[model samples]
Target: MFKVPPRPSTSRIPYAPLPNQGNDSGATPKASSPARSHRSSSGSCFETPVAAPSSSRRLSYAVNSGIKPSRPSSVSKGRSSIVAPAYSNLSSAKKPGEDPRPLKDKAYQADCIQNIYAFLESRGFDKPFDAGMLQLPSSKLFLKIFEFVMKQIDPRFKYGNKPEDDILDFVKGLHYPYNLSRSSLQQAGTPHTWPPLLAMLNWLVQTINFSDATSGPGTTAAQPAHLTPRRFEAGPLTNLTSETSPLDEEGCRAVFFEFMKESYNVFMNTEDETISDAKSQEMMQLFTTYFEEARQEVALDVENLKTELSRKEATLERMQDKSELKKLQEDKEILEKLLSDLIKETQRGEKDLQGYEEVLLDKQQELKKCAEITAGIQEDNALLCKRIQEQRFSKDDIEHMEEKLARRKAVLQMLKENRMHAGKEASKVEIQKVKIMEEIGQAAKKFNQRAAR
Candidate 1:
């Protein structure tokens, strides 16, 4: 009959790892997170916020001038909806009783202006005014003023034809003479401050013109009513607040221009102060963040250290267990070897016992045969004695009687020899049986010893 081979047992198959499988102890790592994926993706790149330098300056001027910049008609709705936090809110809130010192001081203002003049002079600008060069027409102050304005507009601007004529022509375009008061210029006493004052006026004109050009037409309509520049001419210095006396013939305009320059300097100085304040605040916040991060990092380090200690403890325990298991395995192997030796000795003892039993059986058979022979010899001796007692008195009978007596005596002698040989054989068999029994007791003692072990 054709028989199919039996299939191999499933228990014999080696184990294999499955795909995307978790461990039996539930220690598998989790999948990647969405946030991590997004950060790692090739398409993600950060953009720096565009901070317009001109915009902040313009915004400051607009706040003071009542003239606001026009918003774009096509501005994003999302952008328009997002309201920036007020500048006041950007600083930390102050206590009600904390009185702040004034942002500007007259002494500080004068000192700052002096510093500016000193810095300019130090850079080799003409200080002929201080050198007693008081005659305005005799100096190159006008040309210097014109060149300064041109450089402020464009560093590469050159005087193509008559430099003076070109400068005058540019001034005419800005309605210069129209804005200046004739009497004020003639009354400016010492012509020393003329060139700088004119330069200041021209700089202001340029600033206003640039603002107008950038802000577009609708900017004028967006002007706020309350915020207006404080005028120092016939408006405030003389008419409104006559608390101080005039310094010169063009006292109003001179004070006004001086105020403009002072205000501009104050603004610039305050800006630097504001930057310093911001930097200090940033450093404070950075220190705060650094401490917080340091604390968290220290905590993490402590936790990691604890985990490492625990892991090392577990590893130590595992090593100890391995050592114990190895000792147990060695002991088990030694016991197995001892058991195998005992079993072999038992087999050998059983074989020796079988051989002794066979010898005892042979000895018992010999003893039985000797017993039968002795019984037969005793019966024949009794029969022979009875025949001798009944013997006749004839001569032939006497001769037969002598031969019978000799035969009886020989039979007795042979019987005695057989009896003695049987006794010796029985004694030898008893000794061998005792020896065999002693050997069996020894074998049993050995077997018991093996069992106890």
Candidate 2:
């Protein structure tokens, strides 16, 4: 999940990085391509062409070098322009004397260069020479030259009109010198043009070195051009005519050959750095990956530990629950034993209370009998007193007394009848009291009833 930008900084490489940090400073990236051992090799990363070389001049640059590179007055490729069909028609109205092919091609290259230059300028890109401290380096000069030459080949450059003076002005403004026209390059020998002239000389040396490798029309067994992806060529153009001005051919060739030598040195210095940078970036990513994996492992271990801890805790809780249950059972047994002892003591106490209640009941019956005997004695004493305290009576008193006695006898007979009726009511009340006493006795009876029986 770490993301690199559209174009990572030259100092760093995210994928397939160089060794020992981004020290690689070579303009051309190395070709790590495997040999195409088979045309139908399934492992090939790049597609196989149907034909190895279709035409003899498939990638040829055939133009004469006699004329100044034709330049349109003002190259405006895809610029803000209203296509005046009228003007095109008027220009087309020319009397069929001119070859518009070269014109169109020159115009296109100018436009392309202008666009590239404009784009580079707008983006704060220093021109080739200024980039290297106000003097164009050989590589930058070569790249520019390559771009210029490619314009003749790239069909897409044919979109504008510009003049050759415009190109000269562009060259003049360059911080480094390119040997074009001595007038354009030296500028009346103001002594300030030497630096650029020196830069042009540097390029010239490179051009000669490469030119030496190539045998021109005079030689046989010619060595092949150093054809790499970097060199702008479709294929070798042995028969191709050079369209560049003959005046400028030597300068261009000299510059090109000079760059080749410089390029050899530059590649030597920067290849190791680029490799080192790529390798360092790779290590950074690898370290990041290792750390992430370690974190995941740690997280997994933590989760496992937590799960194990929870299991142990659950077991502990179960043990605690069992212990509590055992304790509760023991308490329940103790309470049962205490309750049994208390119940036995309470039963004994209840038996003693019943015995006391029986004794009390017997005493109450004896007291009732004693009270009845005392009442009988008192009645007998009152009778004896009545007999002794009687007074003697005369015959008339005696007769009156006898008459009173007869009246008393009559009253006594009436009383005897009333007493008989009263005795029946008392007997009924006593029977009800005996029945209530029997109910009470039954209620009070317990094991004593069986014992008494």
Computed on alpha carbons, the lDDT of every model, listed in order, comes to 0.40, 0.40
| Model 2 spans > 4 angstroms off | 1-165, 168-195, 201-453
lDDT of 2 by residue, 1-453 (tens): 211112223332212212223333423232222112121233211211111212222111112111222443233334332121111111111011211122123333333334334333433443453322223324335345433422322323232232234334223222112235544342422334433333333232222222334323312132233321111211212232233322244533532432333232232223355654453344335444434554686688899999999999998898679778899799999999999999999999999999999999999999999999999999999999998778566699789888999999999999999999999999999999999999888877865777898
**What is the Cα-based TM-score of model 1?**
0.18
lDDT of 1 by residue, 12-50 (tens): 211111112343331222221111001114322111111
Report how far residue 451 has shifted in candidate 2, in Å. Answer: 99
TM-score of 2: 0.16
Q: Candidate 2 at 320: error in angstroms? A: 97
Q: Cα lDDT for residue 281, model 2? A: 44
What does each candidate score in C-alpha RMSD? 54.0, 49.5
